[model samples]
Each structure stands twice: as structure tokens, then as C-alpha cells.
Target: MTSSRQQYIERYAEYAMEQMRRYGIPASITLAQGIIESADGRSPLANSANNHFGVKGTYNGNYVLADDDKPNEKFKKYDNVGQSYEDHSKVLMAQRYQQYVRKLSHDDYKGWAAGIKKGGYASDSNYVSTLVDVIEGAKLQRFDKMVIQQMNAEGKQFGVQSNPLSNNKGTKAKATGMNLPQSSYSMPVQRREFMLITSPYGQREDPINKGKTQIHHGIDIKTNKDNVLATENNGVVVGVDHRTTTGGGKTVTVEYAREDGTKTRVQYMHLSEISVKKGDTVNAGQKLGVSGNTGTRTTGEHLHFGVINVSADNKLQWVNPAAYLAEISQKGNLNIEAQHNGKNILAEYMTAGTKAVNTDEQTPENWMSKLLGSEDAALGIEGGGDKGLLGNLMQMFMTLLMLTIQMENKSKEEKMQAVSDAVINRHIDISSFVPNLKSAVLSINDKGNAVLVVNDGKKEYSHELTNAEKNSISNILQSDSDDTTKRQRIGCIVNAITFSYQASNNYEQIEAQQQSQQQTIQRR
Candidate 1:
């Protein structure tokens, strides 16, 4: 006799896998979330309405009243459990969840769980942890493997289509068989041989404050006064900071626009001199400055390079510079306009590189054998005849995999150096603030308070945000408003905070003056 959990898996595994094939959601994640949400198919909602995912709203003009977070909530009432699974896939197919569905592979259930939770699929803080636990405990990853294997067998690519509700800009390219134009990439420092990296990206000992670990946002390349620092791509200079005492002295930031209308920014720091000012358009390999030890954060003469993706709303996210450069190097092009697939090329390269490193046994030969059943099947020929068309395709695939394997063999330091050489920085404009804040860093304190640090080009102000202020900022960020609307709302909040600070300071000064006057009268 099998447990109810096992019975649940046996009954619904096919539906989960089918959904994964149709959509890019991991079968493991769907099954685990289903198990948890529907209580192993024993919940009242599941029994009465056949809803396995607790998906809200009516389904085919049918819904069941259920208590979920709030009393008397209407949960979608599906005709059958399979329909529930399909509905769950459709729910996640929304534009907001496209980042996970399109980016992550079918086997990456952990990423799927974390991404969905971060996308606000659930209000529960432990939603990701719980989903991961269910996936691991039930061994649902096998279902994900099954779907991927089937997809491979059919020669079907494993990628999700764009959400129907989202913008349909790239659809024409797919239909017409014309590739979208891609931005070219290059190394920041021109060199004859592979550039020597002084410091790599990721967690490392803080050079200035020894022993303590900190995230090195960018990699440091070994250079001298003679080595010229250059822009990695065709872009316009957005920022040039010339503070030699500390913090990335003599920084030059250039922003490159991608074919998808997104922006990538690269920053070259610790330069001895800057050749371009803000608003200057420069081509790839154009000289920006000379590498130097101008910053106090550095131990020697080198260029500190960093890259970041800038969203339309001005939010910044760091990219691994080393992985990016390694990708460009592997492509054997110093400045080649590669095809854009409506996704971050650097992110895809990093993910593929990591998979190649971690699973060395997954070679092209092994993959062909597993998917095609035998060498004979892969060759698609009989009696030792000429290699067939399938065999030629297999040969091409093997050659590609061999190249990937070679790339994987590169030292970690080399990857870091490559990425560092391609690093870009984005400049955030906070000039909309009442005091015209130049920059702002919002973070939470150890005490669970929202602390905001804003610089007004002259002085920096740190303020512990109140609940209302925090909510206002959070709401503005989470809204589906345009960039201008978001920025204006944020400016209002900043203005309010600054006014409050000024009012408190003035009140304190008046009180102190009154106290001083009282003390003088008492002495008289």
C-alpha cells in the first residue's frame, strides 16, 4: 500500500508534466505547490471544486466559496484536477511571472519557487522554503526530468513563449525568421594576451578593512599607468565621478541601449584620468582613461570594472562581469553583434556555464545517447552507410558542446577577469527630489526599520523611515505606473521626509535658545 502523497503524485504527475511541456514552469514546482495548496488532494477545496492550486477567481463560470487568508473567498472551481493544473500554469503565465518562466530551465525548481515567492505569489514569508521542502521531500524533480527528456526526444526547444498580455514586440522576428539586433561587447582594457586579474568578483576579504568579507561588485584587472581604459560598447557617457580619496576614484560610466530597448551600463573606476565627459557618445574601444591606483580602496594600479542592468524605472541590478567577458571571448569576437533572444545574454551565458561546470558527465555524446536511445538512432543510418542529415546535426551539436567544455575548463580567475573587463555602471538620477538628491540607497536595518540614505551632491542624509513612509515608497515601486509617475511619487516622499527633518531641527534649535536665555536670567 502506498501513502496518500504517493497516490497523489501518481494521479497528477502526468498533468504536471504536461503543463511543463506547454509552459516553462517546472513540473516539480507545480506538483509541490499543488500538494501543499490542495493538502495531498484531501482538502475541502480540492474535493468539492477540484481546485488543486487554490487559484482565485471563477473558472468557466464556476467557483467555490473557500476561506483563504480571508473568509468567504471565491476559489476557481475546475471541472477536473487536470484543468486545475492547466489553470495554475495559466495563472503563472501572467506578465509578472515571465521573468522566471522564460529565464529558468525546467529542472530549476528552486529558482522557480524563489522567483514566484519574490514575485508575490504568496503572502507567507516561508512560501519559498515550504515549496522547496515539498519538492525535495517528495522527489518531484524526477517529474521535471521526465518532461525535459520528452522535450529532448521530440527535438523541441525548452523555452516559454512570451505572455499574451505582455508586449508583443519580438513576435515578428520569430515569425519572419529574422533575428533581433544585439549589442556588441568588448573588454575595457586593450591587451595582446589575456588580461591578468588582480582581484576577482564575488565574496572576498575587504582590501581596506582586512579580514572582513564583502561582495566585490566588480573584478579588478592588473594594469599600469600605460594601459588605457576604454568603453566596452557603443554608449553615451552618463557619469564621471572624480573623488580620488575613496570609493572608486575617477569613475566613468557609459550606458548602452540594447535592441530590446533595455539599457546596460558599464563603469570603469580608479582611472588616473578621464577622457570623456557626461553626455559624450563613444564607440567601442574608445579611450576613456588610464588605469591607476587613485582610489583608497585599491592596493595597486588597476581598473575596477562593474556592470549593471537598468530597468526602465531606474532600478539597478548587478551583472557578473567575468561571466559576461568570458562569453564574448568564447564567441571569438571582440565586437560582434550577436543575436538577441529577448533575454539577458549574459545571464543565459552564466547559467549555461555553471551547468557545464557542475555536470561534466552531461557531454554531447551522453546527451545524444540518452535522447536518441542508441548511437545507431543518433546516426540515423544503417549498415555503416553515409552519415545522414541527423548525423550531421549531431556532429554540429557535439562540436558546440566541445567548445562549451573548453570554456568550462577556463580558470575561475580568467572568467572573473573577462567579466570585469566588460563591467558597466548605471547612473541613477534622483534630481526629482525636493532637495534634488543626487543618489539614494534604501536598506533595512537590523531592527527591521527601513533606513534611507540620500546624498544631495553636498551632504548625505540618513533617515529611519516611518511605517507610512515605507508603505508609500513600497506601493510606488510595486505599482504598474510609468517611470515618471513612480519617480514623482518617490520625490514627494523624499520631500516630506526632508521637511520633517528640517522642522525637528528648527524646533530643537529654538528650544535650546530658550534654555540658554533662561540660564542667563537666572545668573543675573
Candidate 2:
């Protein structure tokens, strides 16, 4: 009993070997017994004292310490850590309780699972089940007896070390346990496939944000870009349900077994319709549905692709599919191009390209043929430009040339005939108020001066313009810019009227003063 700890290690060395071969248990169980009983290798009885097992002492009070408990329990202090290991094994093997367990337990995780359950060794109702869970999940059963024997024979040492069971760290080992025999060398990475091309990622605003409450979890797939969806591999449809917010109406979740032997689940959101059911076996390249803007969709059709990864731990992981898709497409907007007039303006690019543009997604060209045709003749003056701005300018120059020819054909008096009945700004319909005004005309001097001619039949009033008026009229006529509005017209007319009225009023006041001065002189 003096070398009790050493004797225990030596005694269980064979039992340890058998358990290791049978259940992939390691040889380090002695280390655990040594550490715990020896109290960090410094217990008095474990050092020079030489009583390692921490056994109890009776009449010999000098070898024992009385631990105060309900009845003051007696604990034997150890002098050597080695003796403690020997005694522990002797106690376990000598006891009748654990004797059957020594031979009955198998190395596979399931046997360990059911065995621990029946043993009543743990307080947890699922104690054995938890071990089995970790064992199966982490592939712990791979440490079977035959595999260990083969590895040992080949001298290919895996994580062959072990520790004693006395350690309270009875939790299941991680997947990185001893690389004994049956373990998977390299686990495959898990993956899943789904179409998420509908909406812009992270652009959930307002209604898609759902009354400022919930967010649009997935994108709305319109009939715009994605006409179909395919499973990346053979898989079962795991889930499908109408979200309070996922689809404008419906959502489908497809799960597949990854090549890495793990599982991946994908979510399809905002579908106009669904074609498959839960538990349906879908293969790669099967059509999920036409992309649609269903629930929570205000605009265009796009698909929202999401990727999910799950571990044997029953936990999930998510990744962004956008970078993946963009990488696959190589920056192409993923739509067909249609050619139009040489200028390649984006017409109906990707169906309803404008209103339905996905957030974060680039825009495609609207190169479709015009569903509504443009105008034909000079649609200004007589009809302006049938061909738009440039055409109108050409038509105006031609009209001016014709008018010059007509003037050359006429005598000087006849040259004035064209102006006696016209208003220069024909669009301003002040006809009923200024009743006698007949027709409008434009009179230009050789000095590049332009005059607006308003002709009444009985009397011809020539309203001449100053340099300021010429500049204002020229500026208004030659304006060519984007984002034009009706307010521009109102402002121009208002400024001209105000300036002219003020100038005329000043001149009339001066004339009135001169008349008053003449009256005062006559009175003097």
C-alpha cells in the first residue's frame, strides 16, 4: 500500500490498453488520477510521505486529516502521486458496480450513448444522448479498436495520448480529438443554392421596411431578370411559407446536402408564385419560379439570393450572395442587349429597367425599339422639327432664306406688306383683347437687331427695342439646356414686363414735370 499510486497505474495499464483498443480511450487516465489525487503533485503523502491514494486513516491520526462535514469525514493525505493512481484503479475494478461496464461498452458513439443512458452515472436525463450527439456529430466512433490497432501496427501515431477519467471535465471532446482510425481527414465545406436576384441588397426602405417595423428579409423577383431558378445540387425542399414580410406574398426555402457532407439551406423571397412544395426532391437546373415583385414589392422584378450554412452543432451561418453572383457574371448586368438607332441608349433593358432597378445592381441599356414612335415634320412654326431640335433649326434657316427671297422679289413698299398684320410671338393669344392686331412678323436690321412687329390694320405702331431688350429676347430664344420647366417661361415674361413698365413710367413722370414748370412760368 506504500507504493499504492504507482501500483494502480501499473495495475490498470492493461485495462487501459484494452479500453483504448475497444473504445478508442487513451492511456492518460493515469495522468488524471495522478493529478487529482496528488493535488498538483505536491500533497504531503504523495511526496516524501508516500501515501498517494488520498485514502482514509482511522486510529493513526498522524496519517489522516479530519475534514469537517456532517460527521467530520476522514481523508487520508497522500505521500506519493503514483500510489494514488494505483489505488483508484483497484477501487474501480474491485467494486461490483462498474464491473459489467468494463466489458460491455463498444467504441462506436451509439454504444457509448446508450450505455451511459442506462448506467445512471450522470444526473442529466440526456447524458448518454449528449455524448452520442457529440460522438456522431464529431465522428468520435472512428476511434474504434481495430483502427487503433492498425494505426499502431503501422507506427503511424495519431493523437494517441489520453488522460484519466477522474478529471471533472467530463464534457464531450471536440471534433479535433485523437485522429485515430475512422475520422474524416478533411471535412468538406457546406454550401446551398437559391436565386436572390430580385431586389437590391441592404436597400430596404419604408414599405419594404414594412411600416417602419419589419424589414424585407428577401428581395422581390420580378419577371424582369430571372425567369428561372435551379438547385445547385440534388436536394430536398426544406421549407416554404408566406412571410409576414419575406415575399410580397410567398417564400420558399430549399435545402441541399453539400458535397462536403454537410447541409445548406437557401431562401427565395417575394415570389409572385411558387412551383415546388416542401420535401420535393429538386435537382440542379430546375426552375424555381418566374422572378416576380410579389409582397413588399413596389417596383421592378429581381431575385433575392441568400446562402446559408449549418454545422452539426445545429447552428446556422449566413453569407452575402451578391459578391458571389457578380463574381460569376464578371460584372455583366446579366441581360440581353437589343440594338436600335446607332445611338445606343438603354431603351427597355432587362424588361422594366428603370422603375424595377434593383438597389446596388447596375442599370442595363434601354435599347428596345420605341413602342411609341417620335414625331415626323418640323413641329415648330409650321410643325416644329419632325426630327427634333437639330431638324427644327435647319427648317428655321430654310424659312429665313425663303423670306429673304420673297423680300428680294418685292419693292421697298411691298417689303413692308408682310409685317402690317402680324404679331411676332404667335403663341401668345392676346387676340380678343388687342382686337385689331392682324398678323405677327419679325423685322431684323443689318446690325443684327430684331423687332417684334404687332400690326393693327388701321395704324402701324413700331415698338422699337433698346440693346437691353435685344439681349433679353436673344437669351430667351437661344436657350438649350436640360431640366427646363414652365416656371422659366413665367420668370422671363415677368422680368421683361416689370423692367419695361418701370422704364416707361420714369419717362412719363419727367414729361409731366416739364409741363408743370411751363405752367408756373406763365403765372409768373
Each prediction's TM-score against the native?
A: 0.34, 0.27
lDDT of 1 at 9: 84
RMSD of each: 26.1, 31.7
Clash pairs detected, candidate 1: 265-424, 265-425, 266-424, 266-425, 267-424, 267-425, 306-424, 307-424, 321-419, 322-419
lDDT of 2 by residue, 76-182 (tens): 54322233444444444433524434554334445434543454434568655555543344333433444455445756443322222211111111111111122
| Candidate 2 residue spans exceeding 4 A from truth | 1-199, 208-226, 242-248, 296-302, 326-524
Candidate 1 C-alpha lDDT tens digits along 67-168: 868999998987556568777888888877776556777798888888888778998999999999888888889778766765787676644432111101
Clashes of each: 10, 65
Worst 10 residues of 1 by lDDT: 163-172
RMSD from true fold, candidate 1: 26.1
